[model samples]
Target: MRPETKEITTESLGVLETAALLRELTAGLIASSDFDAALAQLARTSRDAIPGVSWCGVTVLRAGEPASVATSDVHRSDLDRLQYGADGPAMTAIRQREMILAEDLRRETRWPRWTRRALALGVHGVLSAPVDIDDQVIGSINLYSGRPGVLTASRQLTAMLLAEHAGLLLAAVRDRARQSELAGELDETLAGGEVIGQAIGVIMTQRRCSAQDALQVLRSASAALSLPLREVSERLVGSAARPRG
Candidate 1:
């Protein structure tokens, strides 16, 4: 038989335990290897962690465009529509860098198109929190529920905390990836430097020219060919190493 699992709810856990739960959830979000994976896990973990969150997802913003990155619901295209259409609480939260709420879509007058679609889908309420990194808004974490009044004061506080944790985790993940990319670039640069040095040595010996003159020749060739300095140097090195035939 399958093991009976119990829901870990805020009501069941005391203050200290709740803190630990939040930490564990935060750690889980950070444990992902990449930002994409982190966001995907965050959707599921936050839905499980935040009370009264029927659906949870992330909206990644770029160049003032909102894109649905991850979602807990199977029919998550709801978020995609809201993003592409550019009218939803998530977009509002991202713009304002604050929480946005639509307590009742049926009675909502702020966004008629969104309210109609949301009502049709049985999503009566929506709570969105801005995901910020270094005080800069990058996106939003959104929750949709069937109930009209979902995010009470206590829930809002918890959702904000979760959004902050997710934002920090994503930032760390992106930073790590950027560091790795820079490291790889450095390695390539060093290798290119070595090859360029070899090519310069070849030119100096063949033409009895100075190192500076040889480098100038290589640079001219690179400029004329519209190729990178590294590529030109690499080709020169290869030509010198080729067996006479």
Candidate 2:
């Protein structure tokens, strides 16, 4: 869903200008290398692009992991307390996979603790949008304001757009990281198999031994050298693959 856009400046930006900025923002996110960088970028973007946003931060909730908060300008001690939790608007957005807003904290009864704390910190309202990094991770972008109703419909849409951009970039990074990890595992597995096979070939040719016997030889070498069998086999196979003058 496309969220509405808002201009933070005194002179509001036009629709075309806003669209261009959003395109540029997503392009930047596509190029970001890590989620941390993306989070920082999104936080900064929200603070600049959305109207009535005093503070911004990201809540990351990866499956099977603890929640973490990446604050852009939520440095106030009271605001910092919201970094980890499942009850706030940010968490609600992630859980519901939709936009959640607290127009006035004093009237908010859904999350009593968060509302009380936020009210104490001079934050009268908030807008949160789900930032799903694929199905395994849940996240949200939260916009905090000092005035009730400051995050109006337009501003909330802008914040939602920012959150979605963040989700897109984070999902890409998460997928890429997982792919790299899988590649590493595959490479290791293939290398081990190749080394063991090559060692067997060398033993068969030089020692006239069967594959099982060659494997036993490798085991013996590993025990004597205090190395893993794969390491010993890798060394043996590597030396054989090299040409000696």
Among these predictions, the greatest TM-score belongs to 1
Looking at model 1, the pairs that clash are none
Return the lDDT, model 1, position 148: 82
Give candidate 1 misplaced runs (Cα > 4 Å).
1-21, 63-68, 80-85, 135-137, 189-193, 196-245
The lowest-lDDT stretch of 10 consecutive residues in candidate 1 is 1-10
Assess candidate 2 and give its TM-score to the true structure: 0.65
Every candidate's lDDT? 0.74, 0.73
Please provide, for model 2 over 1-245, each residue's C-alpha lDDT reduced to its tens digit, 9 standing for 90 to 100: 22333334323554555676587678767765566677777777776666678888778776787666767665543443344345788778877888988888888889887777788778898888887678788778888888997876666566666666667778887777777766764664466787777887888888998887877787678679998667877888888979999
Model 1: lDDT of residue 56: 83
lDDT of 2: 0.73
